[model samples]
Target: MILHDFLPSGNGYKIRLLCACLGLNVTLKEYDITKGETHTESFLAINPNGKIPVLELDNGQCLSESNAILLYLTEQNHLTQQHQSALLPADPILKARVYQWLFWEQYSHEPNIASPRFWLTHNAMTDLKKRMLPDRIQQGHVALKLMDDTLAQHTFLVGDAMTLADICLFPYTHVAEEGGAYQLSEYPNIQRWIKQIEALDWFIPITQG
Candidate 1:
């Protein structure tokens, strides 16, 4: 499989991390979105929206969206589930809870962590006009508080063990501190959990280039 991604992007990190964990043989194709590469006619043919982390299969089929890619890559693997309690809850109610957090990650989490990171860390001052500072800071803290509160109780998000939920949320979240909102020191459970993830054999620090 050929995975076209932005090497520095969290969305791309999601797939790269998953590939490493699953031992999938995926060729990495890095694209420079900052240079308007995604907008090119050829890339738009593969994905009309023109985004990075576009996974193209051997048959020439393509998939976009990071979460979708994660599910696709890991679902059938032995490590498809590491800790069910934290990620894939066994109980119907708890499983639903896991999904809730996963959904929240995409909806509530990324807007806060990823968007602001792009503007503050990557983009030029001219790009600043497009960002909504008040909303970004507001929503980012909201997500952080939710994580801090829930993580205060347990070492992991959904259960005692790390699950897919953690993988889904960790990318944007771990870097939320850059947005000036993350205080992992205040959430000891989360701090411990971060360490655990880092210790995994397949784990790759997304922050590193």
Candidate 2:
């Protein structure tokens, strides 16, 4: 399989992290979104949306979207069962909760947190980024505080062990301060949760050295 992605992106990192945990040997095809590589005709043919972490399977089929790629990768492993446990739950009610947070990460969390980090901490500045500062920080803190509250009660997003929701959310939240938290200094639960994820052998930070 071939995985097309931008290395520093959390969305991309999620796919990579999952593949690593599952022991999938997918070939890496790096793209520079900042350089508009995904907009090219060649890439669009694979995914008209031109998104990163597009997975080209051995059978010549393609899977786009980070979460979708993650689900696909885990489908056949013992981790497959663990996958549903950690990422997708078997119970309809529990699964709904997992989906809720995953959706939140994409819509509420990523936009406010990831976008700002891509603009600020990574030193990729633009006028739009300059304009987004106050709003981004405000919304990001809201998301962080919400996460802190939830995590104060649960060890992971779903059951007692790690799940898809935690993996999905980690990339952006782990670097909240970089985007604009100034200091999520009081969210002790979040800090503790970050340490837990970091302790995992499969954990890989989006920005690698």
Candidate 3:
């Protein structure tokens, strides 16, 4: 398998982190999105949407969307294990909960937190984005608070054991303060959660392939 990704991207990092946890060996194809590398003709052939983190399988099929790739990888792993994988539970209710968090991250969390971080840190800010920043930051706090409140009750997003939900949210949430849009110190539960994830043996930094 090959992961077409940008190292700094949380979306890309999601797949990388999961592969690490699953002990999967995947070749990394790096792209500099800042330089319009993903928009090139060859890259466009891989993903017409021109996004990074497209996972090309051994048979040459490509899967886009980070959470979808997470599910695919976990499901594939489950098939081999022939039992419930801690990353994605087999029970319907538990699996639904994991799905809920993944959807929420894209709709409520990523736009608010990830976009602002990209705009500010990558020098991609514009007049419109400047006007949008305050509201985005406010919503980001709301998202963070929700996660913090949830984590306050459980060791991971869905339950005591870590799940795909935690991996989906961790990338951006852990580095949210980079663009000054957030202060991680304000979310103590989240801080503790971040530390716990970082200590995992298979944990890989966002920049690691």
The candidate maximizing lDDT is 3
Q: Write model 3 residue lDDT over 1-209, tens digit each, in one string.
A: 99999999999999999999888999999999999999999999999999998999999999999999999998897532522347888789999999999999999999999999999999999999999999999999999999999999999999888899999999999999998989999999999999999999889999798
lDDT of 1 by residue, 1-209 (tens): 99888877888887787777666788888788889889899999988999988989889999998877776765545453442332354578876777788788889988777877776677533545455766777787788778878887886787667766788877777676764545556656666677788888878887433
Q: Estimate each model's TM-score.
A: 0.85, 0.88, 0.96
- Clashing residue pairs in candidate 3, if any? none
The order by descending TM-score is 3, 2, 1
For model 2 the local lDDT of residue 99 reads 77
Which residue pairs show collisions in model 1?
Answer: 86-159
Residue-level lDDT for 13 in candidate 2? 85
- What candidate 1 gets wrong by more than 4 Å, as runs, is 78-91, 125-131, 179-187, 207-209
Q: What lDDT would candidate 3 get against the real structure?
A: 0.94
Clashing pairs in 2: 86-163, 86-164, 87-164
Question: Where in model 2 is the C-alpha error above 4 Å?
Answer: 76-86, 122-124, 179-181, 207-209
**Each candidate structure's count of clashing pairs:** 1, 3, 0
By TM-score, the best candidate is: 3
